[model samples]
Target: MKLQVNIQILQLSFLALLFFTPLLHKTISSAPFAAVLHLLSANLRLSLSCTICTFISIFYYFYTRPSQVYMLNYTCYKPPPHRKCSYQVAENFVSRNAQFTEKTLDFMRNIYLKSGLGDETYGPAFIFEEDGVPTLNYAMQEAEEGIFSSIDALLLKTLIDPQSIDIVIVTSGSFSPTPSLSSLILNHYILKPDVKTYNLSGMGCSSGVISMDFAAEILRSSRKIQNVLVVVTESITLNWYSGDNRPMLVTNCIFRVGCAAALITNDPSHRRVAKMELVDSLRTHDGADDGAYRAAFQEEDEKGINGISLTKDLIRVAGMSLRKHIKILAPRVLPLSQIVHYAYSVVSAKFWGDESKPIVPDFKTAFEHICIHTGGRAVIENVARVLKLDDEVIEPARMTLNRFGNTSSSLVFYELAYFEAKKRAKMGDRMWMLAFGTGFKVGSLVWKWLQNSSQEFDNPWNDCIQNYPLKT
Candidate 1:
């Protein structure tokens, strides 16, 4: 329908232009404009007015159309072998630490065993140090390593010059240094002097998708903003919980160090080489609900040591928020048949008010690949339940959590890497990224693949991709 309308408008525009151009010639509209008007019939003047309106309308329609945003390429930071923290190494570290009590040790051990994190999850410098200090230097070092490594590999893969980046956005859940990660990039790379930079913090795991949404809008905001460089990383060295608070200790058991860098562009010339095109993005904030806001909050314990308290109500809050989120999102992306069925089911349930089974729109019908945030085992299962997803649909997310643990904002990107490593994503596949963060924030990004993906040089799962889909 839309294509037919555009074709008709274009034909009308061409005819209008052909007819209107001759009226402006000196022969018709020179100093003898009144004489020319006297020579013209009323029908001719009316035709001229109608033709001019058609031309102006067509011009405005094309002028206001939005530019398409594409992800040219992206790379995830692959930590060195020495950084891999085995289950044994983690157990020994916590057991030997003097700050932990017997109770705390047991709690952490239990959580670690059940957290779905594999032995190879990466850790920052602080964990391997003899003295085990979460110093500002070590935190900064971790951030620099992941950020620089990701950007270096991304630039190499995209074959795009650093100077071509028009905007840079850096996001971390809890770490924000004085110079800021964006400025750090500016100092390291000789980028364009007028490049715009933005640093965002405290948004937790959903930051990557949110930042991508922001970058897409930036690309659409102006034609001069051709490309955006987005770097998402987490400096977990300092955020590692030292206190014995059981809820806080979950961080120590599951969180890991990682980063991802992506180059997004609105330049039409790069579309052929781009990996995916942005289809739609959605974000929801549940901060108004106190239970949601404090579900995962950072606070100092009785001992005055800072740590993020992963409250017991977190899973519940997330599930409730997801239901509300999909209610709004389903209509935009679900197939027409699914939409109709879902609408009827919803109306039937409300009208009957019985204890019938709850209905959920089959998101699998809309997305061919899903990068569900690897927040934790429970978080993944909750999302699976809410979306009515099968285990196969969430394999990447499960494998990512086992391999990389919770890398905060970059978790979904790691899942994306997993899809590439598995060689499952093909050109034209519809991809979905769903992420949840502190403040009970939920974000979803829908994408259409521009080309098939192959193993990347910086793919974190390169050596171990074959070992995935481990026994459930």
Candidate 2:
């Protein structure tokens, strides 16, 4: 706000000086007659008035500069006790309890084995018994526990009073309780009664980045709204599929339990300790196209069992969406030399009819670290290929997938945890996080590290960072 005021003052001062320049010149160049003396005095008075006004404006702006937005810190939820479902255990449980026939079970087993998931991945709700009743109780428990635990920890770590949080935004793609997730948070935390709240549902995996984008805009818009608590999670309990639909079964193999809580504030004082500063963000949706819209859709099976369908066309649609998104983002982050080279490649290919593909700009030049969504092994592979990322550049996403098995909306946070656990992020380093979702949406968040972050004890990967960059 103060920055805007300063610019306006500078503009007005320049215009005033221009208008007075001619009068001052006339006073100096003209003969010192009676009329000339009066005119000179008048010009002097106007000049003094303009100078005083400009000084006052400058002083006011300096004294009243508004706070800058900062991402104070964030915490990703680790699976609760007894929730860590190993691959073999998950497979055995599925074999014994799933409603699908033997052939369909074999298909799911094959997908799981080759899904790039490690033994440590987690699931909040699994029905090990044959006649288990599907319940929202477990889903609610996961949401409540995931949200409260992580948020409580973040507030404690940051020493931020819950009552001071001005806004609460919760994004849970699969489950939204009746009181609303935001309301539940407010009630549980006993936050200020007038705290602004919002709940976003059905936004899919990209919703984590989307929620951050939303918070950034909100902080940019209002100085009074200092702090926002954003919770990104997915409910896996109710989403479990019992049907044999191949598309639906794909979700069962990948989606898992996870949640992340972040405190974003416009309080400039927190900048010193903040993990990263949001540099820029971009979002693109290809849902307008039929193929993209249906790439990942929720539908009932032949027997009317509801489940999310991960269609074969998902990867192609993701590539296309990301292509469009990065076209807009590249100019903002890429170095001028890389941008120029990329532009030259495009022009040469267009005019010279060069059959070779136009160059993909070196994103490594823009970001020191990258976190691609761990939607699945295929999603990570496609993003890496599309961006021409190296093996090391793509390790966080791959390893996060191996360890967490696509925690849906919270997956990127887990990948980010990997970077922190490995101590790879340095001060001033730029990081890029990209995610794809069922809206066939793609979201990118660029962050500049504020400090050289050390590994936090609560980081999900704390116990296993040394074993990562696994030989796949």
Candidate 3:
């Protein structure tokens, strides 16, 4: 409506200019010199006032415009050696469990063998102890270790003080304890009394990217320069399922302990030290559709034990969600050449028969590096197949999954760590981070690397990175 009003006003102004210009010319030519001079002086004064007002408005708009968000640094927590779960250790725990029947044990074992996880992935304290239980205390302990360690390292790396943080955002896929994770961070760090906080739960694996997007929005809209500490982690101790439901057993084989923390700031002074600048971000939710909503759901099995089921329709739901998401995102990030090619393909396909499929846009053309979510072997392969990504392009994701397992929302950060370990990303490089969650939601973060990638002391892959890009 505002645009329409502006157009109508422009039209009226044009018509008035046409109607009055000839009369004004005639008046100047025929009227007395003094009268014409007075009229011209009045017109000049009006025009000058309008020009001054326009300049003032433009100045105000620029002064009050939103600030650009930047990522100062990030760290991914590495569990202690004692907490590492080898294949033998995992098998022993499952075999010794009374809850698992021989059939269920066999099913879980098969899933583990194909889970694309390495022998050194870490589990929660409960899984490492002989008689340890998946109690609430252990869950909190797991959260504390992952969250605090990553945040500590991130603060140290960025040289950011706790009291200076203005916003705190924490996200956990399936864990939400009473003193919410955000509150826990506040108390643990003794952050500023007025620090804003948000605890996000039930957002699934994509929550990391979602939280980053959330932080970017906050920084952009804030009145004053602010710093946001985004903590992305998952407490898998309590979520460890003992039920025998086949559909729900995948989590047991894939999920593991992981956490990541990043410090994002809108302070222009830190731009020189920032790793990446928030370029463009997009999020799409297809949960309104029944299949997408039920793709991965938590429910009780026949025996009344609760577990989250990974339905057979999950792969399809992910593909569908990606299709819908990129429709909106492709235009924003893709170069004009690529967008035009894609548009032509799409428009041409509609004119042709249904047999002629619309050509998929080459996302590689837009992003120099992509951090695909390492949800599982199948999920990674599926994303690669859909995007036609090269093996080298997805090596970071594949390696991170092998090393860390599915750390839920934190997986993408681990992949970013992998990129740094290999020194693959350079200054001015465009990076894309993509992840899918339980709500069948897909989230994307487009980042421009402000500095060349450098492996930090806390990089999760620093020790084992040399052996990465392993055999499939």
Candidate 3 Cα errors over 4 Å, as ranges: 1-54, 57-60
For all candidates in order, the CA lDDT equals 0.89, 0.86, 0.88
Which ten contiguous residues of candidate 3 have the minimum total lDDT? Answer: 1-10
For 1-472, candidate 2 gives per-residue lDDT tens digits of: 4458778777766776676666666656675674656555655757775786677667756555544568899998987657777877777777777477998888988998889998888877545445555588877887888898899879878999998999999998778889998988998889998899989888899999999999998987675748999999888888888898998998888887899999999877789989889988889988889999999998898999999999989889999999999999999999999999999999989999988888999999999999998988888899889999988898889899989898889889999989999999999999999988888899999999999977886888878889988875
Tens-digit lDDT track of model 3 for 1-472: 3356455555555555555555556666675695656557657645654555455545555565678999999999999998888899899898888989999999998999998999989999997787757999899999999998999898888878899998899999989999789999999999999999999989999999999999998888887889999999998887788888999998899999999999999999999999999888999999899999999998888998878899889998898898888889998998899889888888787876545777788999999999998999889998998888989888888888899999999999989998999999999999999999998899999999999999889988888888888865
Of the candidates shown, which would achieve the greatest lDDT relative to the real structure? 1
- Cα lDDT tens digits, model 1, 1-472, are 3466577677777777666656644345565566756677657766775768676767756665567899999999989999999998888777778999998898888998999999989999888888887899999999999999999999988888888888999999989999888999999998889999999999999999999999998887675648899999998898988888888889998999899999999998899999999999899999999999999999999999999999889999999998988888988899999999987887777788856755798998999999998999999999998888999998889999999999999999999999999888999999999999999899999999998989977788899988988986
**Cα-lDDT of candidate 2:** 0.86
Candidate with better lDDT, 2 vs 3: 3
Q: Evaluate model 3: give its TM-score.
A: 0.90
